[model samples]
Target: MRGSLGRRELLKGTAGSVALGLTTGARGSVSAAPEAERRRAVVIGSGFGGSITASRLARAGVPVLVLERGIRWPTGPNAETFPHMFSPDRRASWLTPRPVLTGSPPTVWRPYTGVLERVRGVGMDILCGSGVGGGSLVYHGMTIQPSAEHFTRSMPAGLDYERFDRDYYRRVESVLRPNGIPDDLLHAPEYRAVKQFHDHVAREGMAPYRVPLPIDWDFARRELRGEMKPSYTTGDVLYGVNNGGKRTVDVTYLAEAEATGRVEVATLHLVRDIARDSSGRWVVRADHITTDGTVRERKRIVTDALFLGAGSAGTTRLLVKAREKELIPDLPEAVGSNWGNNGDRIFSWTPLGDSPGALQGGPACMGVRDWDNPDGPVTVVHGPVPFPVDLGTTSVIGFGIVRPRGEFRYDPHRDDAVLHWSRSYDAELTDRIRERIRNIVGGSLADHLTNITLDTSAFDTTTFHPLGGATIGEVCDAHGRVLGQRGLYITDGALIPGSTGACNPSMTIAALAERNMDEIVAREVGKVF
Candidate 1:
């Protein structure tokens, strides 16, 4: 196999291809026997945290192995590497019988290792990405850094906001290279909805600033100029971006780690359990599966150091299950505590007057930051839905400060950790967000309909950004080292204390991972690895 497969050159058996250059030994069929392997360090899930951890450790001369549950999604100028939003198939969901998105029809789909996973919980359902790039692949690319005041309030007091803004945040931005949408692109004929949103915010006496997105603006410009396909221009990026522009983790951090020849990323490796061996080393049990959800092989990997970067839900589920099963007997009490949905509320906005064109240029280029609100800070961003015709509808998503009141309990019958959340967990914050949206466009007929009709416009019990559980300062130390477990760590949204100060968690997650890896590489390289 080649050391690195070009993004354009992927296996072509399915609609969504698997790029196996980093996965040197993965198979398509069942193997003769299970495989056993050992590594100096093992990182689970190749999202922002895992990719940063692998890159940093590999640079420090540590050989690392990364396990991802989903297949790679490679893209180029006009590659059909991902499923479109309007015409989704099995490639839109991960082993789900139907599409995960709310408005999607209940069409039964064949099982495949798709990009998105919807983890159903009490009172809410969480949307998590499944592939090598993890959430970065499916996210709207809103790279936001929380303000210092809110950061200090939401996070552990030890994490210096000034230091992160100056150093680690800068590090993440330098690599991701986020940019706001240029004015020329925003004023394009297709982006009428974005302009409408900005005008509404301005009329409501709020400043609508362009959000920094890790996307190549030129790609969108090219689509507008008829040089390529209309992925970004039409906002048809719900599954994954087909025409490569978004700087996802696989192409940035993971690619760099693989280039060092010290990191091996294994895709289609779904981790089932985690425990410690007799010699105090970490033992991971996983299944190597085909894209159709059939297990091809079972594998055991033992490592001196293990980092849980499988996101808030996945990591917390594994830890909680291990704790209950007594596989890892001495886990902390906070392993399943302090879980949250990041105070998420997504609203569908329909204007009364002018119909914003259906072709809304996106990756969510603009937002209104209401940091001064006494009801707790909130950030609302405008996003475009990939509808082919003018529906006069768009989406506005809000994030705010909500106390983490969700927990996971082990279910023996299912042999898994099930999330338990109250319906009233974030009721107050949800109200604030709803009111804020109403005040933004109050006199409109849409607002009147929202007021009279019993609709989900006020609150939707779903979150793309699930935070906390195995949180920092509770389950782990300030530097993400688990207090009771030696050589075990957390380097994902699971480390955040339920929220990212009213902003999306991606930038903070990346920055915090950079900070934690810095301390870890400096202190524990020779001793732990």
Candidate 2:
């Protein structure tokens, strides 16, 4: 969930396969390597998909090298490894002069290797993560499994929801260990807003369900007990939860992969571009940069197997740029097509007479799944604002089923790819969902609401959940194997066909990768790598 500051307050906030030995470089110094380093497997981006791929491949007796563009954020009790929502610094953004918030005014700062990056496209702006754990580092930890009907409706055919629910989905859950908010935590004094949201949902004749979150409630409880600094309980998770209990991919999957002693994760290595050599090997060009964005070393890595898990924006841009530059021949024409914003809409609602309390507890716990609607399925989650003073406000973010109408086009002048989404891309469906929310909060109690403002952070063609571009079935097969390029694969959100039903894409993306890896390892382990 993308957290937004109050609208009246002026808004704010924010790889391959193969096995081989890795080389080392000097810290903060340039390396003059004569030739490209060779490896058996290289996985780009260390989020859910890449981490899972590396873990599975390593378990299958393959040595893996994982490349992450951002530095590692190691968090502990009271550790200030991440930026706070109210006091953002250079560590809050990726390369941008200011935080990539939609409605916030630009405040310049020195560039650094930050956690989040905003890719500004023509009609849409994508907010993606940049650290070792990728999007999981900043996501609200909503690990939702879409219903079978919705899954079938949005995803490409040939995926069996039954199998996914039984196997791959369980695989992800086993690692992330997602669970509902404990009763004690939800009923605590600090979580009055969450309890109020549940009461409101029940009063509106709808049952509120506890959203499954990959978080350790104990850490939050400790904060309440004054054993740690306030993070989750304070709702200061937009940037990240400083007193980390979040089971982000880096701490879960990537950690396990590294523990196997077969995986090496290179941090602060920004991938520039990718191509295939004459001998049919994958060549990845990257720049080893310092925390201040200085390129210390230019590296050329050749691999036998390559997996692209650089999220939707990063993976899409790399493929689109490679295709336009004629670097990778016969690339899929659909490399930059079928992108969607996941029908994301953020609303700040303040009940007329009720105070939802200040210092709302979160990483979201309560939501309503209105899947039975005839028009289209929609899911709404209650978002808690972490403010020190009561503003009589809380937030609700809605996700709806929408067509993938956005496309990414290569911008030769900028030497990059830009998204082209129509202003009215999913207007009807999002409007329908908006009406559903309005009815729930404003219908009979319309006069009882003090205010309801659509946050421009999401309303202004911006999305925290960016899906598609190099989507499955168009650029790759059902198993994530690129159609024309053997040993090349997509194991990230980019493979998702625009939306993961009406749910967030994390669970589905990881499940799909698990399914793909099951086939890839069984069929082409020793043979390919």
Per-prediction TM-score, please? 0.92, 0.92
Clashes per candidate (backbone, < 3 Å): 0, 15
The residue-by-residue lDDT of candidate 2 on 484-527, one tens digit each, is 89789999988877788899889999999999999999999999
User: Candidate 1's C-alpha lDDT?
Assistant: 0.82
lDDT of 1 at 397: 82
lDDT string, candidate 1, 387-478, tens digits: 88887778888889888889988766555677788768887887888778777755466556643212252354678888888988789999
Q: Relative to the unseen true structure, what is the Cα RMSD of model 1?
A: 7.5
- Per-candidate local distance difference test: 0.82, 0.81
- Candidate 2's C-alpha runs over 4 A off are 1-34, 103-106, 445-459
For candidate 2, the per-residue lDDT at 135 reads 94
